[model samples]
Target chain A: MCVNMDLMATTLPLLDTAVAKCCAEPGSAPLDRDEADAVARLLKAVADPVRLQIISIVRCSEGGEVCACDLPSPLGLAQPTVSHHLKVLVDAGLLERERRGQWAWFSLVPERLELARRALGT
Target chain B: MCVNMDLMATTLPLLDTAVAKCCAEPGSAPLDRDEADAVARLLKAVADPVRLQIISIVRCSEGGEVCACDLPSPLGLAQPTVSHHLKVLVDAGLLERERRGQWAWFSLVPERLELARRALGT
Candidate 1:
């Protein structure tokens, strides 16, 4: 059976705690400490140059997903470094990772990106 | 003479270098190193919990702006600590700082937030 990683991630207890604590429209009112921390964690996940580039590349990929092997060349980083960045993104629920045979394929999590955008009040 | 701090920050040579390099619509194509770095800098500026709260407060303030003196009570932070976060936001061009005789008033720079939103492709 093919399990849906996105749904699984959303339902994970840890992510549920983090994601559920945020998403209040930032411009509508002052965010309390918990809301601010949750939003900040999401922003920090994408606050690195390599990670931002990775997100952009994944966002614009032709098939809507990219294999782990395909990312290093374009990012000009080694496999370990790229994998490290990918792990951070996955942990933050910004990217979904699927195992296809020996390699991992990564895809953007649109809802997470939308949550970050809304947190910015834009 | 009352000068417009937003315009001045937007035109500053250093800020111009950073802000001008990004905003290429992250979903359009892969972002180059410079573009990623620029956008990362902006994200890093607002990646902190205190800074995000400060931005939300200023954005939702009663007069479309807020006095520096009024921030501490809402934030439950010391004046110097709050001021540091304010400086980071101003330096990132995300907030405009205006001097009003004995205090500084902060307001949102809607364009910068929009740029960040676009960079996230939401």
Candidate 2:
């Protein structure tokens, strides 16, 4: 389902209230324009089919995390391309990385997902 | 933050479980590849700031619904452009549209949002 915003004004109140509650600091710093831009970039990062599919696959793997070594084979993508994508995800704070010998295992950071979810609300 | 799938291996289990539970069709069919693409497109649709902002504004508005007329002014975008974005959102099933008199108001469909959320899981 493609959800374009112009048709989604109704869900705005709850969505906005959710975002407002999360992003609006309580008597403290709030999300600035630049911050919003940054967050938007992050959202943009996973907005693609390939990226979204990767997320689903990783989450569906044996553990909540997966070794990068096993990735490219399934995707039929080049190792460098996968590495670049991983870097982007890492930069966004959406994933955390741990290097064990030759394997680099990356996993989801739930708080980041929660935070992004909140961004949607505001 | 932008969650690249390369880094979200961790959130996979929970996300996948959630999606499987919701969309696995009980004892029926499961999400196929084509379905995955469709859902991913919906996410891709809202990956941009312009569309995301429209969501925020519409949800943040009074009663969680906003008229098409009041949209362009805030974004400083042309009416047709705004209309196009709205059409995209509507097509994605994220936003629902209603026409009353001379105005066309669009609002968020929470179930659709929830469905997208589920898609993130599996």
Candidate 3:
């Protein structure tokens, strides 16, 4: 499951506090239980080669969204597998998908990527 | 198994080329086979709750390092479990571990984290 910053902050005050403080002044403290869980969920979503490529493809799409029909051939993955990875990314809040006609178009959620980058203090 | 940037660049020029070009100009293209594999390896390492906490703890340590003995208590995880996580991070090039007397010290690899951040264009 993807944990958004707002939900995480409200649901996990301790972790939210830690993340806020850490972001303001990094290397100040370790992530508490809830914080780690929230961050881990996001990281796990993008932890696979296929998923990473999917993100890259959608991110680089000319129209800012990629059609599901256009993905499998570039990565040499089957259509079903590509759809599965896209589902995982969408579930993790990293990508937004829209069904138009017979195609599913995916776009990158830059904020979520930024959150994970900040969590790693990158 | 963990994949390092250097090995990936040399072994998979197609992906390495994509990464180099992409890094120079963000969102220019998708990750080829090797680049995705290399990045996925690193992301997978930090994708777990315990491992993320461990990295956070070590990064925030006073001495720029933390002893293995000190991790379990703060994280509330079993010692063996913590060690296993540490090993995974080390293998992924995200953390470095050195045995000192009776304890193993772990430290964050900031450059590696930066590489990931750049990869995500965050």
Across residues A89-113, which tens digit of lDDT does each residue of candidate 3 receive? 8876789989999998888888877
Worst 10 residues of 1 chain B by lDDT: B15-24
What ranking emerges by TM-score with the best candidate at the front?
3, 1, 2
lDDT of 1 by residue, A55-112 (tens): 8788667777889999889889999999999988987788999999999999989888
Query: Which scores better on lDDT, 2 or 3?
Result: 3
* Predicted complex 3: DockQ: 0.55
Model 2 bad stretches (over 4 Å): A1-36, B1-35
- Model 2, CA-based lDDT: 0.62
Interface RMSD, all candidates in order, equals: 3.3, 5.2, 2.5
Q: What is model 3's C-alpha RMSD?
A: 4.0
Docking class of 1: acceptable
Tell me the lDDT of model 2 at B73: 77
Q: List the residue pairs that clash in candidate 1.
A: none
Question: What are the TM-scores, per candidate, against the unseen true structure?
Answer: 0.81, 0.70, 0.82
Off by over 4 Å in 1: A1-28, B1-28
Q: Individual DockQ of the candidates?
A: 0.47, 0.18, 0.55
Residues B1-122, candidate 2: write the lDDT tens digits: 13433423444344444456323322333333444555556566666666766776666565778899998877768999999888878766678899999989999877666655555542
C-alpha positional error of residue B43 in candidate 1 after TM-score superposition, expressed in Å: 0.9
Each candidate's chain B TM-score?
A: 0.77, 0.70, 0.78
lDDT of 2 at A29: 33
